[model samples]
Target chain A: MGMKLDEALVRARRALDKPAEFGPDLNVSEFAVVTGGNELALSRGRDRLSLVGVDLSDENRAGSYYQVDESVVGISAKMPGLTVLPFEHAIEEGIIENYVWELVPPDLDKYTALNAIYGRRGYVVVAERKRKIREPVQACLFMSSPGGIQVPHNVIIAEEGSELSVYTGCTIMPEVVGLHVGVTEIYVKHGAKVNFVMIHAWNEDAHVRPRTAVLVEEGGTYVEHYINMAPVASLQARPRVTLAGREAKAHLSSVIVAKGRSLMDFGGLIRLEGEETRGEIVSRVIAKDFARTTSRLRLEANGIGCRGHTECNGLMLSKRAQILTIPELLSSVSDAELTHEAAVGKLKEEEIYYLTARGIKRKEAISMLVRGFMNVRIEGLPSKLRRQIDLAIAMAAAGL
Target chain B: MRMTALYVRNLFVRSSGEKMILKNVSLELYSGERVLLLGPNGSGKSSLIQTIMGNPKYEVVSGEIYLNSERITDLPTEDRVSRGLGVIFQMSPVIRGISLRDLLVKVSKRSGVSLEDVRAVADELNATHLLDRSLNQGFSGGEMKKAELLLLFAQNPKIALIDEIDSGVDVDSLNSVGKVFQRLFSDENRTLLIVTHTGHIARYVGVNTAYVMINGRIVCKGDPKRILETIFKEGFNKCLECVGVGDEAR
Candidate 1:
């Protein structure tokens, strides 16, 4: 029997009957439309319904450069009427639990929606989907509210034996007030694989609180490389992962360049829960011109036959720049193999002399080595992403 | 007199929290001269070479080192390289995260040479195949030496301080390396100061002058034939106690 619109609306309402202090204004029954014409209306309707029209837009998102238009559409069970979420949702008696959404957009604004959701006390707003998407998802998080506060929630789930790549970035409007707090939780299911690249080049004053947590199932692998080349003064991020399955693995790589009195804190963790799990975490931080940076790593292996390696290295270019590295490894399994290394200092004068003896200038030599150190992790990235990251690094290092 | 390749006077070096490695030592090398420094393990031969190259690890207590009449003991290593100072280290060179081709290209560009010229030099040093790989990474012993030689040739330094050029090299590598040295010394104004204890290197590199160092001081100086003959028969112990006059009287 064909259901009536009233019945469908009632079903949707019942689906969203969960406890919400202040919802995004869902008083009317909106249809989950994918068409271009209806998508703008839907966006506008969402803004109006949520009383967020004063700051948000309703433009339809275009596909990523690598993907054709209208590739795929995702709808969330909680926001079933909105039509696009990142994970799969199953409706229970009156609410949806264990919901994982994947939002792969062609442009950058999807990141903005994510920020809006989390910025305004939106709960469990995961910005990414779990499925292995062939097309690239482009997202942009632009802070145009002028001192507006935002805390975005994003969860990434890679199912068993699946593969996915994500590219996300953030941009802040000038004189924008408030804070940008982002939390991301990643799950790599058994034998699954996920690669995440996040580019943080926000405005200088933007305070970003970015946190990521990942779980790896048996035989699954998760690789996350973050490039924090922004000139932002106050930025702190921690991307953590738990190897929960046998033979599960995770690698967290990051490169941070802080300059000009900026205070940056970079930290991450890798935990092995199952037997034979492997995890590697590497980080590089360069501070110059009175900047202060701290890079830390925490590795915990509980299961037998687990392996973990963590390294945190820092380079201080100026006399005023201060850098600290804290590397730790905790293992309960007798068979677990763990190693941690930390080093912080200026370039060895002998090394500079050696380079100069080859006719290289002192400044040029130091710049080359320091910049090269920052790009070492890019060697393992995909070609296109790696190139973009390299460009970004050069720009940041040049202080441009 | 024409400008010599290198000159040192009143050289003194001391290790950190340790005794002096070299005290008031003096040496000089004219253009195109192949010089050898023979010594026991504790001698300051390596220290002298690094000091001349301006290694920051070694502070010049009281000495004046000149390269072509220009004092450069205070300059950075890259500046020394610019002034025609090439070195073949005893151990591996630090590997940078760039392609060998780019490294060679960088050296060539700074040296005012064409890219093809760099390529030709790389080919001459048998490092052509390694140029596409990362700079000095995962290279075998022979290959690393060859790459070092290519870099040296690209720099085209007037003075070369070679530390144990024959160590860790097998017979086959010894011959190839010997031929390169022969070519390197063929041109005047490109001097070399080789440091080694083993006399087998004599068959590979033809030396014009030789000096034996013991206990941070040069004990004797002589022609290559006499030094090799003496070192082969008596070793560093008996030679340390002998004066340059004769082997018999104390």
Candidate 2:
């Protein structure tokens, strides 16, 4: 093992010793990793990976993968496949070896603990300069083994003037109990644009913690859309993005549904650190069936001519369900502008009555409103991916 | 056999915990009959129609409402709608995130009407451009009235309760709306109870009977032309005098 790996492992152990506090109510002390899907291991052990058996097909099957338990069973890539490789390979090839810990260090307890004991932690995708990859790169991470802990690290880099889009879905089998801690880092170079879409569909007992960070250089653009449409035991994630170059821009949005007694704490932070930088964060949350969700958004403008805005909206579906929204904006320079808006409430009775008066049942009317509330249009996404998102949203609303 | 299209007897209603808004209101509309209800603001004109449509906010202290000779006093709003009761609200609430097209689709499906018919209705109302827009959000007064009319057209109810549909509409839209109302009233099988303060709509569509409402009670009922002329020339006080309740009418 390299000296850096040895040092990272030691740091990881020390960080795990002092676990970071997620929230006052969530408990992650007794969680442990389990192993069960040997069939997945045998099938994935082959050299070539096919995503056919997992129900992912053409058009919807852009750069797909099936990660069961601690192993990646099937994996494939299309147009951008030539530049995609395991993170470990990237490290060995010295592509990002020195900058591995720069974005997300082992100082954070979750990252430390994940780096210490994770079984598989390597996937990186790169888009070369000035190349526009029209197709989305799709990936799926599934947890089938009960009580298993799955930790994966992903890195994506967009070179100068390049454009790329990625779609990632993380799910679990029925009735499975597991914890997923994923660390993702993205880098957008000068004049480049990157759009990232992540969909999380977990079982009722699955716990999820995702750590993500993005850095956009001068004149770069970054757009991210995160959606969680399934019921989970508990989920807590706070992603951050920094516009470190002049004239860079970023937009982050999330749509979440909390149901079945699940507890979710989701947040996003953006730091405008360069001149003429801009950022915005928008989150929409729906809570039902005794679920509790807290959404937090913060934007800080520290450089001259920087502008940022944050918006958070939530809907409560039941008396037992709860939703909390907190939006904050901070400006350190006189020329910087920051603003925020937040609202949490139940569907309007008048709106519901309007539909009911048209002969729609109250329940169906509420569902339609909820679906519409959760439908936050994202610009620049491919039509195919937008359709997939629409389907997922419909399924989620029907379940509610 | 003849059947009563709508019948309300001794209808008393209160809003939330407030005092009574509608007191001992009685109304009867025979099948194929058209009636005009005139009242000043806050005279329970909206409450009466909304109560008939089963708005739960208005507590029906003691009342009975029947549609097609079937009692619906205890039915829900949706059930009442299923029984062919439709209303055009005076001030329609904006429903965020739901497009007019989606709402019309749902309404058409539930009413057993085709999407093409709904579109045609919208086209007639000059609301085809609003199909993809959010329901009632940021719409002008004339546009909102047109949208409500389009929904009512799609509902194709046996009896339609139109509350001040002529208010706040432009002259051109008023003419168009009047033309539509004329066509709707041309169907001898359809019934209408239109609530208007200005009685401007009476000029466009024929009204068979007119009722003057004051202080939550109907003070007078007579020929639409005579009563409208009395209310227009000498105001509602004259109509109150005609009912021998001039002192009590507000």
TM-score of each: 0.75, 0.89
Q: After superposition, how far is residue B56 of candidate 1 from its true place, in Å?
A: 3.3
DockQ (C-alpha based) per candidate is 0.48, 0.63
lDDT of 2 by residue, B1-250 (tens): 6578999998989999699999899888988888999988889999898899887788999989999989999998999999888999999888867888888777777777788877776777787898878888889998999888888877888899999999999999898888887876688888899999999888867777777788899887778887777777888887767774222222
Stretches of model 2 off by over 4 angstroms after superposition: A1-13, A24-55, A80-82, A97-99, A116-122, A275-277, B1-3, B179-185, B244-250
Q: State which candidate has the highest TM-score.
A: 2
Model 1, range B1-250, lDDT digits (tens) per residue? Answer: 6558788887888766367788887888888888888888768888888888777777788889888888987876776776788887766455445566766777777767678866765666666789877656788877777776666766677788888877767777667677766775677667888888886666666778888788877777778777778778878776666656232221
| Global lDDT of each candidate | 0.63, 0.79
TM-score of 1: 0.75
lDDT of 1 at A25: 22
- Best candidate (score: DockQ): 2
Worst 10 residues of 2 chain B by lDDT: B241-250
Runs of candidate 1 exceeding 4 Å displacement: A1-97, A101-136, A155-162, A318-322, A378-380, B1-3, B14-20, B61-63, B73-76, B91-102, B112-147, B183-189, B245-250
CAPRI category for model 1: acceptable
The TM-score that candidate 2 achieves is: 0.89
